[model samples]
Target chain A: MTIRDEHLRQALQHAPDRLSAPHENTSRAVLSYARQTLEKEQRVWWQSCMMWLKKPLVSNWQRAGVGGLATALVVMLIFWQMAPEKATWPDAFPEHAFNTDKNNAVALMKDKNAAELNAPLMRRKARATGAPAQEQTMATQPGHVIGQGEHQSIALDHSSPATNEIASAPISAPAVVAGANDSSGAMSSANQARGSGSQKTEAASAELSEAKPVKKDAVLDIMQLLDSIKNEGGQTVAARDISLSKLRMLKLDMSTTKQENSAPCLQMATVDASPDMETGYPVLMVSICDSSMQLINGVAEYNQQMQDYWYRQLQKKNNER
Target chain B: MGESITTDEDLMRKFCAGDMRAFELLYQRHERPIYRYIRRLMGGAFNAQADDVFQDVWIRLIDARLQWQPRENASFKTWLYTLAHHRTIDILRKSGREVSVDEGWLDDEPGSPWQSWPAAHALEPEQQVFWRKAGQRLLHCLDGLPAMQRAAFLLHHEDGLSVDEMRLVLNAEFEAIKSRLRYALFKLRACMGAYLPPMVD
Candidate 1:
């Protein structure tokens, strides 16, 4: 019969039974802990509510709704806190140490040398234990890992030794900040000097030494500035108008290399980068120009032939339209 | 008993009214059953994680006591066991480790624990050792049961809930409920017959 059968029920009634008497101390201990926790939370909520009453952002009607939302977000954040960290890089990348076992063919030619290399094979047999593989790789390679061609058109304005060159980049026009409250060549004095018809460029690198809001629209603004400078600085037309494609292809070392002052932030002087057209290795050019097309510093390399070609093409399209 | 201690609800009301002694009495009545229930339902599968589940179950009870009128129809013990059951089932489901619930596995079977009586007297001592043994034996028998059958049996037998009550708990049909209980009892008797051999009180 099954344990639920009447015979099994009768058998079980007399079956050896173990009963646990609760420990008075532990019971008291648990009760006190629960009470204290609730009391503490109640006190904290009251204090925060009092603070809110003094200067409230929420309306009386919206108070409960806001509190509920905040509570939900807090609970979500707590759950998220318990979640395992997701791997930052895609998983397909070769195992970080997979390349280390290279063919040192010549070095290991000798039979004795081969034996020595294999000596520690047993001792070094350490499996990746508790920590994850991602952690292992991160623990090894500690800095910015930019793949070749991944961001050729991007500027990593980092302060490593290479960025000192960026501070003195060849300027071909007055640097115009399109969104700058005043693009009246204030941030451009450095640009006019670079475009002074001098093939022999001077090394005048200035690094803005201050924390500035890194703008996502900074590249677009820079492109607009190139256009404005080309039109306004008419006579001082130097090389070519910076196109969006060209800007995308070019990477500025906007990474803070040196600090000149707080307000004068994020300024990196180009070291000695030849104009991309000249070197064929993509170059980032910074220029400063006035509304009247005056070159304060930097180069105004606006290619007249290209600009005219684009202008005529546009005119043709407009006529068709 | 004079000052209103008819049920767990009464004791809880007294406890909430600052009667520390009443709270002690209630814990004495429940601590083992809840712990043993948890041990049986999720022993070694979540053995290390059992302490955490135990603490969480009690914390939930503490919260329930602070707010609700305790219970009237479903005893506090049954309610607590139900919470433990639901929480555990949810945990297993979330981990994607549990199998699909098939009522066929629980369809009418015989020679199970709930079908007979001798099995109920399994735990004989609690002073020092058998209490611990009972917990282990309970977990072993439960692990041997099909998940649905196991859940049903616990709801009906250990939890002392009626078939209708179990229908609500398992969300199963009335006929399906009977089958699960039968199947669970059959499996328990087979698994624990040696551990719960006939004995006299």
Candidate 2:
């Protein structure tokens, strides 16, 4: 270093000596203040925490690790809340009941038989009440039939052998029947008769069970009918025709004759009618039958009339009633 | 007989442990340079006299004693100056006298006062008086320097801090500290040249 540089350093180092030093009293004051400060200082827990957080000694990576752990804990808590529960099915059914294919099929068969046994009672109850009963019955049964009228609907009860027999019969066989609108007393009496009829059905079912192959064929027939009807847009013959024993006999013959046929066995024609408007003629009389059926007596009466004439006749007939 | 020298870090650690003697020793060790640093750096700013800033630095150091740690290659002295440097710079900034270290004050015209003074050789008979006046003029020159440049100069020359230690004390980069020291020296020399003779090879 140059002499000038050395002199400059020496000059600067000695320069402060020319200036007045802090008084000795200042030192005493500072130390006494420090003693008092140290004695009086009291840090709370939060203050200590804040000091730690603000501490420069804590590295950036450590702070980052703490933040990341907190974020992960929050995310884990959210997922724990949103997670789906285990064991959603009812406890009455064992988890293993449907574990195997064979067990699954057996369970399903028992359910089907139980549903069939319950269907007739439900239908009887529905007919005894009215629209509300029909809706309740329909909720329990999968099969639905929309009638010709916009508001008329029927829930097919599989427990009735005649209805099942008609479902299994050839499409061209059963003739549509026109029945009088029965009063509540008539329906209650009919339900009583059906209750007695169910006893006979149970005996027939017992006999069919003795012939296992025949019972299996019957079940197959029912399943096939349901599948075909479902595939063919779920329409059925009117409820009035379904209750007729004459059509039941005709369907029994048709089912026996066409037992081997795999084609759709049931044909349906939906007739649209307004439930509020009373028809002068029976609802079945106004319905159009398929070409395969001979409407022998009603055709002559309806052939020469316009729709307005029938409507006028219906109004007059309703007035007389 | 060998006397064990207690390092500044050791003194600070003892002070943190409530040793008043250690604090007194530490305070006395740094008292003069620190007070001069504040006084000279603040340089006639109103209400920022050296004693006030000096007491503030010591009080801050005492209050934050528990937070002090002996970093590798850094002493308690550097930390103490760091506090003083920051506090003085804050005062300088608030008083609006904070000059940029990079300001071009070296381009003063030939008619400047320092240029008109008699050369150092002409006053060889009164060397003692001339040196005293030169030292006083050097202090004046220091006050005229930018706050950071003055701090850099004082930290280096007055406190014997190396460029690296000055970097820690001033919170500046190595190159920045180096440049500040260079500017400080150049300006001081230009101001001090009026008192010294041109060297003969």
Candidate 3:
């Protein structure tokens, strides 16, 4: 601010001005270096990308958002791959070949007999077992005289003429009948029934022959009743969908039907028939009037023994007379 | 109409975009001031390294063109001087010269080499001679001052920087710049006063 300070400032300014300028060569060299560097420094595409990545392109919030979105996408993809596929109706119900429309199903059940409705299924099963489809249908028909053991004969009153002839023929030797009741007692009953002719066994056989027609009629009535109930219930009886309550109700109905008949003993057993076309579930068939057979949970060995004893007694009386 | 004068920042931007003429203009504009800043800061003993340091400063400015941003309230000249100041300091330090800018050197009593010189008579010729001698002595006095104080003095007086610009160039606090300038002016005055005759009131 003072004269002395102002003078010193001026002196200092004038003293150092233009005192130590760089030589022309140094300036030329620096410019030449700049030119060389600018011309030659051509970065490749990947190098440019790397440079961009190395720089802070986004803020902390943007980075977090991007990371979270990527993580969520990955998790969703993993879950989508790991999830189980759902079973469609066709996969669950292989018998989709049968009518699915409620009205059509009821009409079909009403118009067709059990044999006619089960014909397709029976054909499939016959193919699987390597048996003729006609033979299988005839074997399941009423009054077919399906014998269980070598000496045992079952006679129904509605018997076909050929089956009636076979039932009435005298047993000279053990006969190996081809039927659905292929039980283990088949061969053993021939020897067991040789010398056991009791009066009770003969009387029971006569009673069975007399009541055969009633039993046949009762079985047909029960089948028609069950078909009507199934149609009214608006549900097809699939093998898997048949609950225990429905089976119990069927057993109660059969017991009522038996009470109405003159047959002293009525037995039933649930046996697996052919597998369904699509679902592969075993079709359930209820065998009635076979004392040698037992319910699903009953002791088959005891029932078979009892039936074999009765059969042997009947065969012995036939031999004696 | 007057032609628009292009600012240093504009020239630097044009240089960054590959205009060699802009760079040449920039280099020409700053060459003397920057070179003298290095030379003065390095002092007479390290004068040989000044050219190298000066070239390094310009080369650094050239290399850093891409990274340069026009700072708020600071010019390209301040930035250039800053680079020169730092490079000169680095060279001095690497050469093992005493580059300390601490205030410890301020307390050292002024030498009496100017005491034996005869007084100038009150004539224009003698006055001119006296002032010329004083100018040469001022450069010598600048060499004796501490690096930071000398920088403060030369930056303000020679390069015509304001106090704030000196703060940016020196990378020091405002008050620190003020104190360094004050000390620089005081020391230069004391040194030059030894050559002045007794005041005639």
Q: lDDT by residue for model 3 over A1-321, one digit each (tens)? A: 211355666566556344557888888898898887676465577686556546687655445444544564564356336533231322222232122232111001111244454556545544554555555655345322222221112122113443333222221111111111112233123213122333332343344334332222222323332333333331333121232111111221122122222322222222222332222222223323221222211322222222333344445665686
**iRMSD per prediction, in order:** 6.2, 3.6, 3.6
What DockQ does candidate 1 score?
Answer: 0.06
Interface RMSD of 2: 3.6
DockQ of 2: 0.23
In model 2, where do residues sit more than 4 Å from their true spots?
A: A1-4, A16-19, A41-321, B1-4, B46-48, B104-125, B199-201
Please give the lDDT score at residue A74 for candidate 3. 68
> Which candidate, 1 or 3, would have the higher TM-score against the true structure?
3
Q: Which stretches of candidate 3 lie over 4 Å from their true place?
A: A1-4, A41-321, B1-4, B103-128, B194-201
Model 1 Cα lDDT, one tens digit per residue, A104-129: 10000112333233333212211212
Query: Taking the candidates in order, what DockQ does each have?
Result: 0.06, 0.23, 0.25
For all candidates, the clash counts are 95, 4, 2
Where is model 2 chain A poorest over a 10-residue stretch in terms of lDDT? A245-254
Greater DockQ among 1 and 3 belongs to 3
- lDDT at A287, model 1: 23
